[model samples]
Target: MMHQPMKHNRPPMMKRIADASEPYLYSAPALILIVAVMLVPLVVGISYAFRDIQLLNPFSGGFVGLDHFRALGQDQAFYGALRNTLWWTGASVFLQFTFGLILALLLDKPFYGRGLVQALVFLPWAVPSFLAGLNWAWLFNPVIGPLPHWFYALGLMDEPHNILSDPHLAMWGPIAANVWWGIPFFAITLLAALQAIPRDLYEAASIDGAGPVQRFWSITLPFLAPTIAITVLLRTVWISNFADLIVVMTNGGPADRTQIVASYIFTQAFKRLDFGYASAIALVLLALLLVYSMLIVLLRQTMLNKG
Candidate 1:
């Protein structure tokens, strides 16, 4: 040290830079692919929202600024779609979470035919969404479906009729199918969370004279809270943008009673050939989703802090 550390050699600047960037160099391919596949299309779609881009028009790709957004602001059908979106997302998420938690709780304990029951619970998730929609549509059809007959026998319906064609009840059809298909997601995730919980906590709670409900509220729920918040947020976003089942089952039919924002975008883009308008709608939906996501994240953080 007294002799200037024996004139120890250091790598040149270029060599040091290369060594520092080794990790990024290895990840460069994935980054490039992501930019090309996701970022590029995202930028292009955002540009479309500010232009006149009709697929049928030969010279339609012209900048229109906020014209599409202004028109969207005045579209009554778009407003109706917003309302339906709330109902659809709310009912579907609520029912799926409720039934899924019950199923998960039941499956957490040993029982006869538990394996078969679990398989059946997860079967709907494996089925294609389009196929599931079609199957549910058939099940709601008065001509061939037994549901209407069963409802009639239960004194719940005036007659065996196709509820999907009835505007008053048409929304329930897709909601029911969505709940059935989505329950498996919540069930699987919740069951895993349930299993991860330590047996000692349950034993300790029982020793302290905690009842089933008390134990669940005191121990199980606190452990599952984080998982629940994340799963609910993900499901909410996915379901809000999901139009496949609605398009396949109802096509926003019965006077567009089932039209949601996602399906509305599809109708504009494909049926009307109005790419600009569709992009504008999509941009708005994206903004809304971002806001919702921020709220969920903030709430989760607050809960974590309190805990």
Candidate 2:
């Protein structure tokens, strides 16, 4: 009777192989979709940079290597746009992140109507970028909006003149609009990261006689560092590529003072119908962004290693 115990047989090798491949088979459709939707377009865009692809010309599909880049190298507007892009990206990110961090800290504290306050603060982010740009443009107009009058009242201007028409001051209009629209994104991300920090750690620090500033530096900042770094990187790239507000508000106008690289690309593509040139500029921008991202990642890795 003891020797009569039956043994179970293992599944065939083919069956095991099929089971192992089942997860990949299930995910294949999504992977294919991503490649079709994102990767194919990117590859096509890169190809366009090397070929003449004017939107209106039916016979403009001829390959012209490096001609667009050569032309771009001599374009003064492109150079100006590059400088404007630096100023635009830097100012927008700094102001947005600064105000966002402040707002997140304020929201972290429990208070009456906290939820309502958060919703209101985040409302601007939901507005369409073009509409936000138009709204800010109106605000700068002296005839219809209050900002100009407010500025004049504050003695910052001789009259309620529109700053968007002033080449020196025009960049600020889009930058200001961008900051207002982008702050909520940073605040939402930072607030979530802040809330995820363990309460016990803060309590322990307090129990050990750590001051508020010290606790923030030691506990809060360290926990938020990774989040802040990633968020800043993503926002930097996004804002650099964002042309909607600038195009809608300034149209790269007032002598192209507010024109950034993204807007410049748009001008070449749509206004001039030079898709090849636009794609060339876009490729250069893509290269710069990749280099910038790689540097940031390497720096972060080095800091992590040292820590």
Candidate 3:
């Protein structure tokens, strides 16, 4: 019988080890950075949530268990902030997405000076949140800003009054500013998704006697569904945690009318110098956001499966 040639079933042990270790070696730096930057602070903050960590007190870092949480449970201001957060997040996300989608659709069509228009449209997003807040705050100022006067002229207001100072309308000011600043994010993402869609699909729909609305509903929207879901999810989480515009514009003023959970956390940590309470609030907010995110992801997965 002919002697069978010896077969090599695997690479050398050292080679296999090197191959297995290569990916980890390449990823080690990023893992280390994440741990150092994100994970370390996260662990520390979680620990602080269970302790007394006032910055002004020399001996404040003592373990306090769930006292902070118990206090939070009874804090009516926190409850108010939660309600305001819902309104702020809901209105901001809705208006931003609606206007952004419209802007994206308009820009997707060929037009004169499309580049200039796109640049101008996306300009707000590039502006620092602090600057944007200041600008919007100025605009809402009856003394310096033209918006109040314009509204008065339009009969939307009885007089050219500063809406930012009105507790009933103060939240709207921040929400409006946030919508203006955030719309571009949705627009850019949606525009990219629109461009990625196959041209033939729209053409085919047109050839099948579909009208503009029909084509949009049947072709454009289905393709955009996933992008919309993701962008909305991200924007919701971000806007919930966002405090810059609110802080700069109203400082959660006029009776804490504009105070969201994020601004409340800022107040606790910086203004009150109560790091432990702030950490506890932050931890709760983090948990709530995680839950919201998981629900959205599950919903998206269900939709994708059905589709």
Candidate 4:
């Protein structure tokens, strides 16, 4: 009995061990690499908030705890940046989701060249953000801009000059550009959600004499609610930190009216050479993004639990 105990188990033992954890081991390298790359820069940037650094001494700076945060509190630019960021996040996400939902619902029905039309609508989002900004810049040009030309040609405006320079529309110009840039993403996501919805629900509703309006209000929208809410949260997070369009289009210009948190932090740190203060501002932005994301996650989880 004792001699038979070992039982030549090495092959089966090796197979069992491999089967149990080889997948996790295979994934370990990528997980570590991602964590190091992402977390290191984030930690370094956050640490700078406690220091009093400037471009003149980028390599070394003194610790000045909370000073930068204090400075940012009194900075009018901070408040302006915050205001514009809220406007960007709220207005762009709202309009983008609205139009996207409409486009998705329409496209959900069978039609000719539907694929082509959807692709065409999505084309604006396919272009690089910087290029989109440049195109918008030209479109808003006062003298020879296409939009002003069309507008003035149609007798819509008094001038054919730069519309972005107009105080009334300058900030809005970026929002519209951002919205256009953002719409396709929402459409694609919502369309995928719409397509996944059970067709029998619609037929049942129709058989019950539910009109198009009633069906949509009752079935279509409720099914889409979770997806829409998540997308809005994500879009808000994205626009809050999106600096490229604002940078290339307006440079947060025309007197800093278009300045958002990201661009402002960039200006304070690199442009103004106030590293510490910029870090402080960046931390605030990070905190804001954290709050937004947490709320989205918690709400989504709650909804899922309720369901």
User: What pairs collide in candidate 2?
Assistant: none
**For residues 13-132, could you state the per-residue lDDT of candidate 1 as single tens digits?**
886788789999999999999999999999999999999999889988999999999999999999999999999999999999999999899899999999998998799999999999
> Which tens-of-lDDT digit does each residue in 154-209 have in candidate 2?
99999999999999899999999999999999999999999999999999999999
Q: What's each prediction's clash count?
A: 0, 0, 0, 3
- 101-208 in candidate 4: lDDT tens per residue? 888988899999998998899999899999888888877886556788888899978878676777556787788788888889999999999999999999999999
lDDT agreement of model 4 with the native:
0.85
Highest-lDDT candidate: 3
Residue 222, candidate 1: alpha-carbon lDDT: 92
What is the C-alpha lDDT profile of model 3 across 246-268, one tens digit per residue?
99999998899999999999999
Clashing pairs for model 1 are none
